[model samples]
Target: MIAESLIQRKPPTKESAVLRDQLLRDLQGAASVSEPVARQLLERLTPHERWALLKYAGKGLRDWLLAAYRDAELSAAPGLEAAHYPELPEFLLDRLQDWEAKNRRRLEARIKNGHARAPETLRRMMVEPIALARFIADRGVDRWETMKMSDRIAFARTRPKFAQHKLKAFITFIEGGNPFQTRRGRPPKKAKKVIKEIRQIAVLTPDELKARLQDARQRLPADQYLIYWLVAKLGLTAKVAYGLTLDKITINAKGRVVIRPAEAWFAMPKSIAPTMEKLARNADAQWPYETPTDAAAIPVFAAVISERRVGPEIFRSETTLLRSSAIHAAMHYGQLDRKTLASISGVSLKTISDMEFLVPADIHSLVSHDLVAKRNRAILGSDDE
Candidate 1:
């Protein structure tokens, strides 16, 4: 059995005294000791004793103990440290590894310069490049330089929106001039509509939509819930919500929240005003807006949510919420005119148009009846005729 005594003993034995002295000496020494060794040392003490040791320890020893305990706790739970980088699989070629290392260094430099704040963001950005490298290697095309624009487009067509985003970031780090044409593979608006319609189905009522959001709020973290709430209430897209910065948001004199997404400023929902104010205050305290180093570049949602990779699953949910909200807005407010709906929801005109088909049959009939009546009146004919 491990000794229950701490560094400070009730009746100090010579061995106990020697151990304490050795620990202190190691802590004060310039050379670093491994956390596993430190954790082994700590396990001998009881929980209360460990707390007591930490309380009396000097700042250096205390910090080391805290780190050791934290590491131990995280190790006990897999994925607790979300930003921990995984080792490349043995199947990956050395050339691919070198390219990944180069990209990683570029990402590290970005972090050092404050261009990117989160390590998980870098991880997400690396996904497509790593996947592409593996794909090419499997096909015996190990070097990325040999890939053509058509090859890149073929790979891109198979990817979803999240991977596409990562692919864009990955291309920027390529050594030579951009190998593939950046704008060549973009699908037209009509093709997008076909895809959108295929994905969307019957619309939910406003109440039903609100209920779903409430359920999500309970299940999701606070930061994620806030983003979804903004999308639901303000009709903002999740991508837009994710990119919000403190500089773009301000609390007005009358205690209303105003957000400037583009050239125009829009008032946010009153229910969320207090939360926005609190977030603004917290952000202001952490990174003063007046700093010359682009403190305003820090995204409010991204900063909070970037500890773990927000992959395709989250984006898929966001898309569902956005489409549902669009339909809800149409049903709740009886909004017509594609442009007006587009302005309100921050979605494209095409999305608004597609959502119109999902509106209740009663609403569609009313619109059809109105149009028919207007046409008859123009011809100077009665409804009976």
Candidate 2:
């Protein structure tokens, strides 16, 4: 049997109770708390009370309180320790470990979800110079230390799965003291070969690309016309076209179709919007079918076909079948040698030059410079500003 303590326990002090209540209120209203107010509150708290507050409060809320205090110190003086919470060291280390474990689990889930390349990306990050790796690793440490948590919770929030893997890798390196060495000097500059290749793809155009869409439309469904329109006319990357909805397309009073592109609508990176608009115009001219009545309706692509209208089992498939088919049709019509067709169709020139397939000239002719430029500036980039 355990013996009772000889010393009697003391009741809570009125000051401590008031402090606790104020701390809770501060945490709850942290978003609106000014730095000066946060610093003043911190100044009033004893070290023990500060530690107790951090230990008891939610991690996110605690981090916000500390951050406000830190910001206050920065605005006043460089070395002011007004925001310093010594108790943070031990608490932060424990929290960092917890974050790392959570991140590892998320990475595993992503790998299971077909993000098989994620591990390779992590490995590449691990191989970077110590300074760069340490910088990223420090972000994870600081994020956890201040309770401003998350694997990618700093400047930009990463996808949960990716964030978990990246955070775990970062924490591991920090704990291990980063075995990778910093590079000795500036790395050699490699020739901008890919940049030139991209420019070539951008400028490439077929002398005449016609009849390719008509022939492909014969074999494909009417709804699939949008895919052809995107690939041939708008200069959209195939991935962007997959996310297109009827809402993004509008028919002006002039009878021409206008496509408003959005970043969320396309799964690709935001930088690709310019290229995508150029591709959209090319697609619009080649597409034979009229726009649908319902603006909210999503376009049906051959890749995502299923028995049910919407189901748990529906999955994305081919992104560029229409473009490939168009290329094949162009080759068959004896217009295969034209470099301009590759630019206009948004297919690589090498694909056309190497492949024996024929695409019609009529399809290529639809990609007018006037239309391409209009779509590029108006739909993809800023036309108004």
Candidate 3:
């Protein structure tokens, strides 16, 4: 038995060890590896892992691998082809294909609207002719119609390159109905549970606000701290705070800081209204100017403006400061309800509700009116009549 075992076993050798080490080095340097090196590496991988590696690799690495190993038997894995994603539910697939087709039609409309040619890169990608047409045909024109004319044209020119032909083929395969002619009934009113998950607002306690300010001052640079204070404390949006001119902010005779809005800044007052009021009051209390001085003498917003002459000058375009402050404020304390918070922030209520990507929080505190109305309506049922 011992003699038979010895005959069956193959001993590890120096040559095999060297080959294993070289293969690892090649894998480690996959990013910078040349096409030939990548092909050689792929040849060593098991058939199963080869496809996995190709799919998971970064775009550049994958391209290099493909260029290097194109000679390999691609047909070896018929299971991994694009056509093998399993037939989705007919209804679902039809819906998706309809959406794509409508999107394509809208793009064609934009092209007919006299938009300029697409960028060279987009043209090379074949986004202009093929993919967009299929997309419009499937998706319909609602979303595309809402976009600005210039933007619509841009979309028309660039969507074809990625998988235009493939998308067209998919649509053809599905026998999907025309997206434009498919009249959708009014969508069901969203359940409270669904809305709760999507829209949220948070209110910060005084202590929470203090902690956030402390963290901001400690963590952020000096210039950024000032901007943060203007947003988090005063409640200015980044654009408004950055657009502040020296002339807009002044200490009045009554020892109150006054912030007269600039034309550019006045157009939108969502984030700045709170901060603007707070900053004015604080400035007046902290540094009261008894008499009027030249507009240049006063500090415009918190940020420094380049020119002393100030009609509509930007203070500092440090948008990240506002974003970071808002994020920190939300994470530390919580988010506010959309409606109530929107009122406080001076943003449109509709805008708040529509924003889907925002972090979820209980918005009852922000939009108590809506909650109250909803509850009251539920209590007074239709059967009561």
Candidate 4:
């Protein structure tokens, strides 16, 4: 159930009410019952309506819409108030707001100059500073200037190195001209070696890889299975697959399914070509009012089970596991080199290189080279030689 406080909030204005009604009517023009309403559907809904729709929607719609909402929120300005953290002192809150406001102005200046940046960027910049500020306040430290290097180090130890690095901007802001720098450098070579060892051990054998693919195909729904197939076979990341558009997928003259994400084109596996073709047809047919070639006019994968629109956020947890398993399988089989793996999977070459240790050093083919040559000779006839 939606919270009573949420449901009890002020009702929509007459103008917005009419807009919502019109939007609901326009949604009926979509070509298929399974297709989502236009992208504006969630944007048109009031916050209360959005909450109700999310709660009542099927898994597919909720997943898609939630991701949309999050993206929208991140791009919008964030509210700054002690209400967000009631325990923080007024002075601490002021300091935090001051820091946030300074960054906000810089972002606004960039926007004014035509370099558009989402407030999410500012939010990211402020998050660690606010967290560190709160940490200092909680320890009864009233002034940031009074804090020592030891205090900063104490906080750094609790966060990942990347997050800890974010404090540099805050330190510069606080110290005016002389920013405090941490003594820490890149993680030691020993730590890097340990991580590489872990990746090597995570490699999957051929039989185990086959079992995983078979199990997923048998158990997952058509829409989800398609996602898994894309990741496992073509090495496309789940996010890339999820955002695939009708314009990005096509059938080449050779009767093969081709997918273009960004500028790169990859042909789909023959085993799954027919399914992809059908999905493309369905998606195109679903948007009768618009041309399928129109960028993002039709999402390649969408809700199949219900009218309620879902978001990609639903599959957040599983994407990593699917991606990791695919990488491990590829490494073990040694079918694709580091450069090829990076190109197809959108994984960094650095990461692919680091995981190269997973490939077996002494992998041997089942058939000897001479036996393979003899079989080829038998097939082709000695006369050809």
For all predicted structures, in order, the TM-scores are 0.46, 0.27, 0.27, 0.53
Model 2's lDDT to the true fold? 0.41
Candidate 1 local lDDT, 14-45, one digit each (tens): 63355455545543332346646556766655
Candidate 4: misplaced stretches above 4 Å?
A: 1-126, 146-150, 157-162, 177-201, 245-247, 270-293, 297-322, 331-334, 361-385
Evaluated against the true structure, the overall lDDT of model 1 is: 0.53
The digit string of per-residue lDDT tens for model 4 on 124-157 reads 7777877887787877787777878888888898
Best candidate, lDDT-wise?
A: 4
Query: Global lDDT of each model?
Result: 0.53, 0.41, 0.42, 0.57
| Backbone collisions counted per model | 0, 45, 44, 12
Q: What is the lDDT of candidate 3?
A: 0.42
Looking at model 3, which ten-residue stretch has the lowest summed lDDT? Answer: 75-84
Ranking by lDDT: 4, 1, 3, 2
Tens digits of lDDT, candidate 3, 1-385: 1123223223244533344344445576752556466556677776434534443343344444444444564311101111111234344444444544555455445545744222122223233323343444454432322324454455546655554444443333335444235557997896476344444444444566677678867765544455566566545566544445434665545534455432111222343344554544332332223432222222334323222322222223433444344543543345444433333334455644544234355445555685666644443342243
Q: Quote the positional error of residue 275 for candidate 3 in Å.
A: 14
Scanning candidate 1 in windows of ten residues, the lowest lDDT window is: 74-83
* Ten contiguous residues minimizing lDDT sum, candidate 2: 76-85
**Strongest candidate by TM-score:** 4
